[model samples]
Target: MTITIERTRTAPQPTRQQPAADPKPATGSFQTVQPDLEVTAPLGERYDEILTPEALAFLARLHDRFAHTRHELLAVRLQTRVDAANGRDPKFLPETEWIRNDTTWRVAGAGPGLEDRRVEITGPTDRKMAINALNSGAKVWLADHEDATSPTWANVVEGQLSLFDFLRGNLEYTSPEGKEYRVTASETPTIVFRPRGWHLVEKHLKFHDRAGRAMHASGSLVDFGLYFFHNAKALIEGGRGPYFYLPKLESHREAKLWNDIFTFAEEELGIPHGTIRATVLIETIQAAFQMDEILYELRDHCAGLNAGRWDYIFSIVKTFRSRGRRWVMPDRKQITMTVPFMRAYTELLVQTCHKRGAHAIGGMSAFIPNRRDPEVTERALAAVSADKRREAGDGFDGTWVAHPDLIPTARAEFDAVLGERPNQVDRLRDDVQVTAAQLLDIPSGSGEVTEAGVYDNVSICIRYIESWLRGTGAAAIDNLMEDAATAEISRSQVWQWLHDNTVTAEGTRIDQTSIVRIMAAAVADLPRFEGDRFDDAISVFRSVALEPEFPTFLTVGAYARFL
Candidate 1:
């Protein structure tokens, strides 16, 4: 589905209704009430409400003071609007309909064709890495200020300072191969910088231009406010990219707030309204429940939603940790895509996005291994391909790749899936039948567990069980309980779990073992079936698990098994 929104220019409309009466005085100093009716407080208590008559008269007398303050605020807002309009808002380009409609800005909507497409390049630092990622072929490359790279106050300041430099074509960086690359003033890619947390705006102001001006001098660049200030010709002349991926979103309000801010920024920046695009991550259970509302909030601007696997799992565990015995753990392998709720969430995302003429994108394939090992690379590539295939089959337009080596595999997977018609499989409906017992088992200790100490043991047990079932190789638990090659693939499955949790000298944790165990568990948990049919299905599961790697079916299988 393709979504095209036209940008329109318009003045700002009042967001709140006028208050009926002046606000009453507070205990000591006078306080104003919020103008909105929803503010339950009495008049004069809310910030936007006018104070008592005396206070109002006094405020009237200080018209000049208020005017001065108002003018200053307007100036700051205007500057921010300009910056945001021009795509120089520091952290991200403010997404608004106007920005999207601006004749100067053009964003190539990347869909299934570009899902697995990535161009690998190196940069000297995280900033450089960002620039290179943009230049590299992916439609969006997150300048991770959050996880992959560590940036201190100085780094943040320098990075912001370097934005203009990057735009002006004066950025240089050395690749890992020791090759130096320079970006001149005329070259710019679709770039987005992940800023420090909203609370750290003060620290981001340390670096300024040659005149010793702070980047955030007007206080317009606070807490995503930067996306509004830099909207002007100076920035857009290079290129106005109207998109952003909002990470770590925990509620519908956050999405709604962004929508409101974008609405205001569009008007202030003179950009066409509704041009900016955003993608919110469903990383927490709160976000999961609010998905419908959150997506509704940004329907016009939203590109799609992503299934944030690891963080989502972490959130589930955290949200339900207090339940004690009621808490059942998710299978490690199934954690990525298999939880029934997660599957439901993903399907809802896809359905919502498609319904809105948007493209649903998948989350990261973190299992892709290092590039140095040929065997690892091949395995990683195969796994990535399978994942992409599953995502495509599941109606996702794209997926994420952490390492460059997985790029080709991801692309191929997307291509293969895209080549097939969507909705081809009758069983591909988003809904899956799950019983109450299955739901209960989701948090059971015997189910997939996430407790810190038990992860290794559970993982090992799962892998060993699968291996034994495969009848290919023997598997042992803690170097004991060795099972000779047997038709019981369940034992080998246990070994597979152990392998997934095994910590190598290189510090890389592979999920292959977990994958096998998940498959075995699924086979073991199949519904009551007599003789041949059950045995045949179990054999197929064992064969797939014994294979090097499979697609993201672990989640589906595990969820089914749990059910």
Candidate 2:
């Protein structure tokens, strides 16, 4: 049975079906929360292969079982942030000290295609991109739907269809200019899907709660459910099972929730237990402090841990936005891996992951080479080589890239270190000792906020949000793959600098007056678009970056406005 969306190319929206909110729970051990499924946008050609009744029903089952837990966890996140903003600071969890102290337990061995992830290219699941990524010669492709994808109904549904086709060896695309792209089976990277973070919700699919009031489904579950429901068996039967890159995890309890969801899904689908493996991104400041415990919670299904450097910085800003000038960050460019605080985070991550026998993956190098300029390309390649060399020397099993061109550079670095070995999990970095004080030291930057930097932030945020509103999450700006993380850090630095009323190195004080002028200039500088996406982007940026209270994520507010 085909379940195509009602597509409208201009602004594709899911069709509406507001089923009367039933005030009572359904009968049986599981109270069935039947969602009023609506295909708001037109499902493009061949979408039926993924949006079938069976697939939606499978997602519904996942929602019925785990939706409540997801809500409670979100509540916990809110309260936790509130506490941090209200003077309660994040530190090592004493309660889960036992999990951290236990050194004997190890995560299940790397399942299938995850054994060698020396170079992973990350991008959205667009049709041509999907085929190109698979044939990118990288060891793994992070099929991203989270920060890297704009969650328009069309993008959400079509991305699923694209992955479905790739998995079945039926994926191919021709560009608007008539360039053919097809997946090369020989060079195809093992696919690892990165679902949206837990904080967001899929507003179109409204499922009733126990009280029978309609509510949006969890974005994490929607992405995970649809993918797992349809392709788990096929993936397992082939070389690799279903693998995931879990993002924005803030606590070990959240990790436990994911492990439980995986167990339940495996049982329901009759797949063998432990077939699903996930690499958790320790993005939030809170998660960085609990890396060991996070691994312990998902040890049964954990593949490893990734140092999500960009969001980690964004989290530091959000968590301490209202704190004194001590937490005020300098320019975003000043914050690098070499900084004492960042070094503490990455070193601790490797120590924690390797001590527990899990792969310690490095953060992303978001440099896109400019092929037209030989000098520019050479400089970019040198920077990428240096970054990967540092990671390999520091005991990271692998590193991630935003473009396919950097794969050779990254792989060569890891290969030089690994020789014939797939990974260096055995090289436990016992020499690294990180303290809480060092990790919390936010003074590594020069404390120089320049007006140029501020204007740059405003422009990038506006440009990024404009692209995002137009259904592109990953935008190429200044030869970098700028995702939500970039925008988050950008808007966040502005807010932080403003809250502290920081004076730029050029003697310009950052205040509302200066910011409004910058905003106006940014809007004027934007290229003409025939739609209100530009205006909406400006409003969203101002609201999030200039508001009295900081929103957890810029994407959360913008998601409601756009998608």
**C-alpha RMSD between model 2 and the true structure:** 5.4
Q: Rate the local accuracy (lDDT) of all candidates.
A: 0.43, 0.85
Tens-digit lDDT track of model 1 for 1-563: 21111111222242221112223433555343322101112222122212223222221222211223433444553454344334331221124333323333222223222222122121212345555555555544554433232233333334444454555555666778998766532333344433322212232222222121222221112313333243233445644544555655654556765676556555645766665666676765556655556666776566557676655655444343333434434334444465565666677666645544455668766543544567865765676677678777787776766544556677666567665433222223435343324422434334443432233433343443344223212233332222211112222233343334533333434366544454455446444433223443444444434444431222124212321
Q: How would you encode candidate 2's per-residue C-alpha lDDT over 1-563 as one tens digit per residue?
A: 22432212222232222123234445765443334344434556766666676666566667767888888988999999889989888889889888888878998858998888899999999998888788889988999999999998778878998888877888888999999998876857888899999988887665544434566778898899889988898898788999999999998889999999999889878888889999999889999889988888888899999999999999999999888888998888878788889989999999898888899899899988888888988988998999999999999999999998899999999999999999999998889988888888997655578988899899999889989999999999878889999999999999999989999999989999999998888778788857748888889998999989788899888888767
The clash count for each model shown is: 81, 9
Model 2 compared with the native: what TM-score? Answer: 0.93
Candidate 2, residue 407: how far the Cα is off, in Å: 1.2
Candidate 2 residue-wise lDDT at 264: 86
**Which model scores highest in lDDT?**
2
